[model samples]
Target chain A: MIGNAGDMNVVVCVKQIPDPANPGSLDANNNLDRSSKLIIDDSDMYGVEMALQLVHAAGSGEVSLVSMAPNGETAGLRTALAMGAEKAVLVSDDTLKGSDALGTAKVLAAAIKRIEGADLILAATESSDGYTGTTPVQVAEILGLPSVTFAKHIEVDGSTVKVQRQTEAGYDEVTCPLPALVTVTAGVVEPRYPSFKGIMAAKGKPLDQVTVADLGIDAAQVGGDGAGQKITNVTAAEARKAGEVVVDEGDAFQKIVAFLDQLKVI
Target chain B: MAKVWVLAESAGGKVSSLSLELLTKARELGDTVEAVAWGADTASIAGDLGAHGASTVHDLGDLGTSLPGVSVAAAIAAAIEAGTGPDILLVGQSYDGRDVAGRLSAKLDKPVLTNVVGLAAGEPPVASHAIFGGATIVEATFTGSAPFIYAVRPKSFAAEPSGGSATVAPLSVPETGATNAATVVDRHVEERSGPQLDEAAVVVSGGRGLGEAANYAMIEELAKLLKGAPGASRAIVDAGWVPYAYQVGQTGKTVKPTLYIAAGISGATQHMVGMKGSKNIIAINKDQEAPILQIADLGIVGDVHKVLPQLIEALKARS
Candidate 1:
């Protein structure tokens, strides 16, 4: 369901990732424990902010959100709704748990197709927790749409959207037509804090919930059973030993250089 | 003998160091190693790629100065369709590299393993990724068909020249109509006086302990005196004290310098994942028990505001 005959209709992908500040525990399957309190990934805020700005700039458009979480947890989705998204589409099902990047992308692409008249899809380059960094492009590929990644700046003109894509050495100015997907980098824009009025208004926002059966997605195509890549084993990294410490007693710089000399790094 | 292909990135006719690193690693995993490049003449870098164990170099010719994501990936997909695809395709973790890998995965309906740090020799190959901020290493393997694509992190592997030359070849690819639709209008490179944060041998980073945005100048000055690059923790960057280009963290750029000096940073897991691979780590903060100190090779228990000025002066005097 799309709303408002605005200049553009944008669907922003938001993730409710585990809080990075808190150490996460592993489940019986050795997967991240999703039972903990989840929060909006820091990187996803830029995409939401960018979509809001684009819709506002267009003078008459609506921004909807799409998220896939375990057991239909909407705590993270509600945060995005508070940021002024008109509605949300949450795809949560037991069969979708542990779906790899590709399977997740497939589900998101299906939801976007169901939206009827979406012109653009925006997502963060990667989730703070998963950090697979390929889902947005995978979604684009499944939808047969052109995709741009690591966009630092975006401008919409007529039927085309221009982006300043970040590069190793610099940035490249790339323009693609509407019906494209873009994944934005963090700090691309200053995200606005949800106001009291906006937060209160979010309670009434429409959040459409769907299941794998509703989307007609095969259970075998998602979750651990269908993942193309399997984490065969995981091991703890060797702990770094407590090294030498020096009180900065006026001659501390010399000690630092001496240590650097030992390592031949300076 | 598995066939391996690396997406070589180039600028001004020189191949990227990360591509060379991939080629070096590819040599050990496959019997045949090839490289594919776009937008620039491949002849200039063919010899360079060969030295890294590439047996053949494929050139896509010039596709204009636009972003190479669409054109390069389309060319590779066409090659795959023509029965010239490799068993494994490796690309750097850079922006354009990921764009190409993503589009190629889409075109081929293959899943791409990204942020790979290590690889093990196998029939299909296994990739290792550092997760939860480098606290754990998880190994994954592809279960599907050929052409297992991976976007590898920079500095994960060492690039060594084998001193061998390769045969250069021109690959003809069918025109993909969507390649040219996305055109480049302008380009801007941030003007920095010193080494890039990712490539710098020494990176001196500042965090919120710098107190105010203006105090960042001291970090820059110290980095300059040490002949290194200036970096920022997520706190400072998020506070608008520095541009995102200088941010060193999981959400930012992953850097593996010879020496990484963290000043006043609390050593959050996100930031640690980016620099934990550095050859050496040194932390300078007043809090002796900060998380960063746990990983630092040398922890200086002192105030950065007081210690940084003196260190800068000492470095200047020595230089």
Candidate 2:
């Protein structure tokens, strides 16, 4: 297979976010006021799975995990390493905090450029938390790579790839060469779990510590500076209240008439 | 001299609706708005762009086709690099837009705001965007060089008309060939039976209030009568009331229309972001205090199963 012996390098960019699939309430100013535990979003996991499949299929490639989460997110990167990534690179710094979608993409692209010379990169269609659905595109743009976003199906044959795009109305099929990028959509493929041995071996893997300075990057380039679009204010989402219910609980004939009269259902 | 630029996407060699809106919003921000089109139809760039208030349209000729981010950014950045780019770049907040905005910002070393709703360009570009699934509206301003990229949210700007002559120019792509990356052998668009989902001024969505599958016909009847596309809450889909494709929530699609009517909905935070952009929301639930009514412009306290049928009948009668 094409991947049999270090034929290509795969890079998966993942983010650590609070789970939104589980219902929860938000605090004032609209931040995820959750308990301080985080996990990798499912979208990123699917991305990792796709890369793993490609590497496994070609038989000669390695998968590398790259993330923008701070030291607090080390646990999540370690999990990626356990999931079969050969190594982990953590792009963390005080300067890289509070990043929105664009800022995060900038950080990932800069980090990707500095670490490994990658032939392919993948990410989730969108994060479950911010739900911007814009990161993949932004990341591609930042890296100056050709991108295929919202892909429901992806097939790589040697140097070229065939992608099935998910649209509101239907799906589209597109083809692109290697050294390209893709954002996998939900329901594309389920990511496998890290085996016990994989988990054990991951503890010995290098979780490289990189900051805004390691890549000759300035604080401004990280998140808070000129390269980012900073948020000045945050407003809570307005909630909705319940409405009145009208019922008719009489006999069949009378119930129809009453229900019609009360609900104007007639 | 402030100028706003719209990078348009094309289908079968014509511009897209979102591109039109991008140019319209850009026109709102600057004295001179430029619509840049690169693809099969370079000749029509000036005319289409001028119609949307583009004072200058650079037509990079017969450029095989613009890929998501590569070709689009190369053409746009080369212009900016050579000093023909606009003060602000407005793109539709879709996959293509994100790609272009990200690459353009990196190449130009400027700030790019994704999923931005509003823009104010002065000493710097301030853009209003949604965060935390529309729970918080974040106001952002970029302090960087010229040609800041913005992926504008949908329906934020009513695509208005601009009258001007499209002055076509035979522009050229940088050392990079006319084509960037990715080949477009075929493009498939989902067929809509009624008004387009994003364009529908009125949308009647189904929720847990829908009850079961057999009951969804009533909701469809209402949507068909109103000539609108139906939106489904995750509850209904999760409950097998409809397909997951119809679901509207944080993980699903984000849309805005003129009037949104959610029935049997409890108004979860994730669900609200998808429709909160609507100009008016009307919620009909049996529970008078159901969560869906908070953002509703008009809250109708009643059973949706009953109210919906009658409303459909009323709409049909009016028609």
Q: What is the interface RMSD of each candidate, in Å?
A: 2.3, 5.9
- Candidate 1: where is the Cα deviation over 4 Å? A1-6, A245-266, B178-180, B317-319
Q: What is the lDDT of residue A157 in candidate 1?
A: 83
CA error at residue A137 for candidate 1, angstroms: 0.9
User: Candidate 2 chain A vs. true chain A: TM-score?
Assistant: 0.82
Judging by TM-score against the true structure, name the best candidate.
Answer: 1
Evaluate candidate 1 and give its CAPRI docking class based on DockQ: medium
| Residue A244 lDDT in candidate 2 | 31
What is model 2's interface RMSD?
5.9
Model 2, residue B139: displacement in angstroms? 2.1
Q: What is the CAPRI rating of model 2's predicted complex?
A: acceptable
True contacts kept of 1: 0.67
Model 1 Cα lDDT, one tens digit per residue, A1-266: 33445567899999998887888767888778888888888888889999999988988778889998877888888888999999999999998888888889888888887776777799998887888788898888778777778888898886788998876667888898877888887777898888998889899999999998888888888888777777888999877776888888877777787877787755
Candidate 1, pairs of clashing residues: none
List per-prediction Cα lDDT, in the order shown: 0.84, 0.69
How do the predictions measure up, each by TM-score?
0.95, 0.79
